[model samples]
Target: MATRKAIVVGSGAAGLTAGWRLAQAGWQVELLGPEAQVGGLLAPQPVAGWPCDLGAHRLHAPALQVPAVAELAQRIPLEKRRRRGLVLVGGRSFNYPLRLTDLAQGLGLRGGGELLGSLVHARLSGRHWERQRAPEPQSDIGFGEFVRSRSGEAAYRAFYRPYADKVWGLDPAELSQSCAKQRVSSSAPWQLLWRPQRGEFLHPRGGFGAWMDGLAQLATQSGARVTLCQLSLQHGDLANLDADAVVHTGHLSAALTPDQQLAAQLDHRGLFLLWLVVADGQPGPVDTWYTPEAQFWFGRVSEVGNFLGHPHGRGRVLCVEIPQGRHAADRDFTGDLGELRRQLAQAKILSREAEVSEVVQRFLPAVYPLFRRGWLPRWRLALRHACASGRLWPAGRQGLWLHCNLDHAMASAEDAVRHVASGGASTQWPELAERWSEVRVRD
Candidate 1:
């Protein structure tokens, strides 16, 4: 009857959740993170008196029912709000979770007709059924093919193609079908034809970081140790830690051997979060704006005030996500401010006369996993190598390379803890890992 010791790596939501759960289960837990604070992307920092996240992050309504997520909700007050956003396409503003009427009106006669015709043609030609009956392995089918099969060429080119290119900095043809399957919610053209309705989402009273801090506090209260220190498997750094189980919630590369790392060829897309304080700015009711066009350097822009339900005031902060492709040389992003402002004005997100009071730039490496074609096999191989010792458990978005939401990370943490509780059975984890692989990324 000895107390079990668990080491949880990468103090993000998954690591913190695993630490909390293990501690509550009467196990000794040590949660470690490279950053001083927890929450990873969910961490919020103050920008011009307004709390802004690294990016626009929110807990979808579906995650509320999760036991761990529900526990966090109890500790921190979560406000349920209807999702509001716009997608700017071809110089037209379309309500996000886009509506058919809006598209028809925005595209006008010729464009709308082509779009409608394409959809009809796709259906009549049974392209959707053909896609279902595609003989090629899922890995062989590219993102471009998957989208075109379901939504037709018009929709693919109009939105999916350009947006995927802008966000991931990869040709849609180079991206895996799994990427489309996980990230694109509406696979069928008919799905977009439905009447547009706002969806509900959850957010903490202060910011998402509050929830992470709360989880860490709860974990500590339950007798878990939290540390702000870096750990590396490549250098054999984790070899000395005396733990019955190690839950790794960082990038898979971090846990791999140097040779395995080279073989895996794993890569990530970095982000430049340009936080701007606009004086006398009116963001309207929109929470986020998606800009797929190449003219806009930033892919997505979010109004922090809208998330917290704060009214238009003297100033508001906007977080703009600019994807810095896989191997871009690091340089000063401030130089791009003028172009950003001009584009923001052009998009009508900001008034031309509005003065940008202050601008802060934060560069986050590895914001997203680059899901290149045939990446699954490599990812699985890396995961297997990382967990070969049977002591390490990879969990969370980064750990699993899953483009999932915060709730999914917490749920994965729960599953990891369950596996550890079962005496780290070798047979149990592969099934769990397979299940994790199938988790669809929610936008």
Candidate 2:
């Protein structure tokens, strides 16, 4: 039998995983990516003498259970770290994965009473339960409706609404219920307070990029070839590549026919990262600070040193993530560091006296998928069109337009390889693609 050939596009966690798995399965693999190094967003860059990830990233405990991820752990040294973060709202700091006592403290006696009252009202009314038992015909509720139904108006207004708006740059009502179902782990107030804490996560010794590099090394050792180049392939171009199977982990538009691309109208939310060195800054116990307030320019700020347990003598390196919408102009990229500092100080995450020694700006073109209302059918159709060739299989966050964890990406890659091994049928891929859509995004 002739050796099977596979071409994996995009070098993020998913593409690299696919390349490695295909090579391991005795298939000839060629992994193509724009950057010389693998790990798209997972890749780390040198900032202030420390390797800082593009954004705040970590391997959650659940992700470690994936076979591919587990195997990578054996190759790379991973450190177990507890998740510690704060959500700044209404000039108060509340523990993330919020605790009841902390919520009460943050909301105050009367506000806390109101919140509980609202939850009781929601339960007593039974509207949410009724909806769950017999959902509407469309069954595609809005994000605001989903949260309000389960947690009541108070929780939605106080917590979910602002954060959703800040992250996706869409009105909660315009966003799909799928966004809430996937992004939000728990919506019930009691569940939010009483859920067993699973704060432990894994981090590679060198960083997330190192893990990708490790996977790439394993793939290369297994005879897979890697190329550093960007490719734009149309529907007719699939025949040109001398590979039996092509795994696309890039934007959906990249693989779609021009006609399909024009009709899809699918888009992604970009992220602006402002890396700063705070001189003489004392590292806080909190690894990340999430700001939902619209007044603040950034959505989340993370201390890079805390991730690796590296104590810096001069200062701490902070990565501030600012969401950029599609309509945002180029000038919007120029973030105001002074205003950011003022907001941080106001939020009590930073000292007013702290001085920023250096600042660097990095922008990621696509970080989160804009899961607008009525996006499911459109995205599904787009994906279906992209994979109609049977040889092309869409995988990963960008390819599937899924807002998911790194582990999900690896698992998706595994699925693609399995499909290819099972005769690479186009008919079988839609079901697998549907399953990929159900993957939830982990914080």
Candidate 3:
């Protein structure tokens, strides 16, 4: 056999796994990325001598059972975090999923009616959406429309619109429902009404980045080389970088040269997160809180200091997340920690004297692909055709143009191994494809 090798670009979970799998399968692999670190968006922060994750950190329990993720988990310490999400709306507190009893009690009869209407709409619409075996929408429709149609006007205003607007920085009407379906947890009126107890949240012992760091070590030791400070793809040049095969994992925008076809296929998302280290405070939940009322500048706020351990360690570290479109650095702390503190005070979630110790801002671009309905078939067709060529292959969120979580990225890596071993890629691997399709999304 010719000394087989492969080049994997981007050091995120997807890139790392692809590189690792191929290398483990006896093909030399070279992994490249744009930053000094290996974990793509899953990077970590240091708060008062402890690790804090700024990006998606926790893993659902179901993810651990996967062989690929399990291997990675074995090398690192996985710890479970508790759930305690709260919503501060209309000067009242609703549990994470929005409890029916709480909503009824807090909002009185009128609020309860609105909540009930949303529930009925969601149940009816959700069934309609799932039953449709025909083609989905052609052009993108806002999540607001879908929610209102399926769940009711009040539901859209109280839950869907506010949540979408805060996260994506666009009217729910402008944003694609594909993103909403992929990212947010499904909530029928009944699900919200019941307020079920979800499973435990998981993260690395030190930092989420630590998990990647450990995975990278395994990949490198298995004969895969990870390189940073390199960008752009030049056909045969990528494969020639001391490897036999190549996996392109960067955002498609970052990979492809200017082309109209490439541009249209590549819709993207931007992200802005502000990290705050505060005195004598913590996130007080598993890892997240969503702001549907838009009282704060951030769509979501996370107390990573608590999940990563080091709770009450002199200071608290919180990450305030804003979708990239509306997040301007010059803007007045758009829903960031400062604003969050202000709102917390108003909601009585925090005391008047509470102050932020430090604030840091981070911006990310093209983190998500804007895939509209009916686009998936065409996308799958194109991807199938492209990968069939055996040279240019899709990898990562942009390359695949789909939503994925960290474990899914690693699973992609494992799939690459199977492809290399079998001498090609195929949809025949139904089980593998289904597994890949279940990846989580962290914003």
Candidate 4:
């Protein structure tokens, strides 16, 4: 008997996980993607004689609990450390999660007193941000409202609003608050008095690329054929394809056929990355540093050498992330290496006389799902069409238009593989949609 065949689109973690799972289940699997490297966000890019990931990437601890992830953990052991992140707001440094006491300290005595008073007003009388839910998925309020209600106007102004503006490119008053739920964790006010606890984070021994390579090998060894640099089928490419199922881990915007009018309704996001090769001892020990100050164009910088314990042999490397809107202007990409060096010197992350090597500039397109008010119906309409087609199964961050972290992406692949195995003949679109929607995620 001929083996059941499956074609998995986009060889990122989700697609590779799907390919491995299907192949293990006795199906002949084929994986395809546009890029030669396979990890997606976690995929490490070589720099200055060592590996530097797309940005900062670590196996979020919450994701280690997933069966597939747990299994992968055993295959490839990684170092676990307390995640240490820093944030600079209003010329003051604080913990990345904004611990209550630290936030109070950052605000001077008078400002802190005002913040406390406002908090009392917000919690005792104002609408509880968490309790107040949007009537419909598409009708959710902006992230600013929730932040103001939760932390009061003073706190919101001090940190959240500026951070949102710098990172998301959307005014806090415009984008959906659901984005906050994914990124920020809400703790009890009482917990503010207590010191924030150190939590575990993971990284591979060599680099993120080693971890991705392990995952890719697992799929291939299980009998899945992976084709690098193979783009997902456009109209003409679909003609010769024959498979029991097709799993897409690429952009939904690209998946839309010429006739899908709702395609324009959904807009994804883009990104700019400035990776610098600096002297080994220049940057500090922080894994991630975020700034809400307007003077700095980059929002977050992660020290790759510190995170993975593997520097490029001579000096350390840093990856700075500047999240851009899907429609960011062309001029945004025009800065030169000298400008970047100047910015680093200005920020004091590096010295003016520090030995700096090549500056790699990257522009990533259609990488994130950008949601606006009343976007659900249009997004779901596009998803519904993709689902009803009976041939396509969308998985991963871009595929589902969710900002899923490393672990959630793998779990999504699991969900997609299971849905596809149920057979396309009698599949229900709502059920598939619900499964993807329900998976709990960390940003």
What tens-digit string does per-residue lDDT give for candidate 2 at 295-360?
A: 787788988887866653457988888877433625344356667778778877777788878888
Model 3: per-residue lDDT, tens digit, 362-406? 666667566544455555555554354355456655556668877
Q: Give the residue spans of candidate 3 off by over 4 A.
A: 121-129, 133-142, 230-243, 261-265, 282-287, 311-313, 329-340, 347-350, 372-389, 425-443
Better of 1 and 3 by TM-score: 1
**In candidate 4, what are the lDDT values of residues 150-226, reduced to their tens digit?**
76787677666766676567777777666655555244342355645656678888776788789899999999998
State the weakest 10-residue window (summed lDDT) of model 3.
127-136
User: RMSD of each candidate?
Assistant: 2.4, 2.4, 3.6, 2.9
TM-score of 3: 0.86
TM-score of each: 0.94, 0.93, 0.86, 0.90
lDDT accuracy of residue 348 in candidate 1: 81
CA lDDT of each prediction against the hidden true structure? 0.79, 0.78, 0.64, 0.70
Candidate 3 C-alpha error for residue 30, in Å: 0.9
Q: What lDDT is obtained when candidate 1 is compared to the true structure?
A: 0.79
Evaluate model 1: give its TM-score. Answer: 0.94
Please report, as a residue range, the 10-residue window in candidate 2 with the lowest summed lDDT: 128-137
